[model samples]
Target: MTYLGEIHSRLLDHRPIIQGETRYFVKEFEEKRGLREVRVLENLKNVIQETNEQILPKCTETMQDYLSQTLQRLQAASHLVYKLQQKEQEQRKLNNQHLLISEKQRITQWEDFMTEQHNKQAAVDEEHRKATERLKEQYAEMEKDLAKFSSF
Candidate 1:
């Protein structure tokens, strides 16, 4: 045989071996790829679980603290409003009392003025009565003198 024919025959003999090697390598690569995918999934699951265990609680606690502080601030504001209402109420009461006192003072002054006017009227009436009595006595004396002259 020629050298080319010998080479072709040797190639035909090695074909089955090469095909078998190719199939085996493909199977190994698929298995390694599947294992790597499974490991990646497992690592992802672990990371998710860790986040749940560590970060979630911290976030929840921080949110709770913020809510608690908000509640306290609301309560403080409510208390301040209550105190302001109470102060306003007291001020109103004081104002009413002052108004009442002023009214009483005004009434007292009115009563004093009325009493002074009554006293002045009484003094004028007494003087008029005394003057009328003195005029009657003088008229009686003049009539008595006229009667004596007519008899003479």
Candidate 2:
């Protein structure tokens, strides 16, 4: 119903007899003039429909291209995220390995220091035992000499 109204309006707008008539009764128009206006409106409608048909495919193709490009970008972003996650995992593993190596080295150094201290303590104990034995021998010789002098 709206389409028919639009067609009628267009016909009235295009008619030469009705161009400047603001107050003329629409029912008073001659049948031949009305027919001519209707034909012109029908022709205009046909031209508009043909133009829309010609442009519809290009619009649809443009929309499809935009969607395709958007999908490609999303796929690329997804791949980048995956690669970043993998790299993070690799870095975490390397850090753990570095920590382990440092801990092992620290333990080894502590063991070496403990062994060196033990060796030094053992040498000091041996030297102290030798000095005590020499002191006991000297005291025994002095006691014998003093006894002989008293007898005489």
Candidate 3:
């Protein structure tokens, strides 16, 4: 766009040089030739001016509008991507928390199972000790009965 503007400016600046050369040629020729040459130069000037002032500016404005709309769409897409990333991060955090809670529950259940097993073992040991004590008492009573029978 800037290059187009630069070329337009250069054309405007060089208009006088073209007119000077045309005038020099008209002076070298006769009156009819000078008149025809001047009219042709005027027509060419009009066309160039219309193209520079009207057509170029309209085209430039259209290009600018297109670029602006494209930039807006790109920004919208970027915003959506950012929102999705945030949602994904939030989901990951929730999943991790759920896993931590589940692990804690599992660990608690295992501890309870171990404690119950220890309690059962302690009961079995106590019963075995009591049975041993009862057997020793029976043996002493049998020895005393045998001695009394022999004396009689």
Candidate 4:
């Protein structure tokens, strides 16, 4: 869903270095509750670039090159992690929206069912009222006839 494929690959390239860095830092510093706070790889990306252009040309040290490569990897991993987090947030929001829509639809269906039942009851009541009125009329007629015939 994201256009961070290239970035993700770049991040993968530095995985080993970042892992080692994390392990080293976490092991080196034990006082902190979390290992991530001991950022042994601080600004490696910046250092790598500066060293490649200035220090690498002058010294040609393998350690410097290695450090640079590791930094580049870390930077990519960091970018990918940020993008993934955003994607997760977006997914959560979308799920919530879907839930809201479903709830509204359910409520509408219930309301429609209630209205239909109410209409049916009203129709039935009307029919019963008419039938009762007709019966009352018939009863009145019978009573009148009996009175005339019986002289009561």
Q: What local lDDT does model 2 show for residue 23? A: 32
Candidate 2 lDDT score relative to the true structure: 0.84
TM-score-superior candidate, 1 or 3: 3
Q: Give all TM-scores, in the order shown.
A: 0.43, 0.43, 0.44, 0.43
Off by over 4 Å in 2: 1-64, 128-152
Give per-residue CA lDDT, model 4, range 3-99, as digits (tens). 5876776776788789999998877776564445435455676788899899878786777888999999999999999999999999999999999
Which candidate achieves the best TM-score against the true structure? Answer: 3
**How high is the CA lDDT of each candidate model?**
0.90, 0.84, 0.90, 0.87
Per-model tally of clashing residue pairs: 0, 0, 0, 0
Instruction: For model 3, state the Cα shift of residue 78 in Å.
Output: 1.6
Q: What tens-digit string does per-residue lDDT give for candidate 2 at 1-152?
A: 99999988778656656555633556445543688888889999998897788767788888999999999999999999999999999999999999999999999999999998898888888888887787777777777888888789
Which of the two, 1 or 2, has more lDDT?
Answer: 1
lDDT of 3 by residue, 33-100 (tens): 87788889999999999999999999999999999999999999999999999999999999999999
How well does candidate 3 match the true structure in TM-score terms? 0.44
The lDDT, on a scale of 0 to 1, for candidate 3 is 0.90
lDDT score, candidate 2, position 133: 81
Q: State, as a TM-score between 0 and 1, how close model 4 is to the true structure.
A: 0.43
Whole-model lDDT, model 1: 0.90
Candidate 3 residue pairs in clash (backbone atoms < 3 Å) = none
Candidate 1 total steric clashes: 0
lDDT of 3 at 65: 100
Query: What TM-score does candidate 2 reach?
Result: 0.43
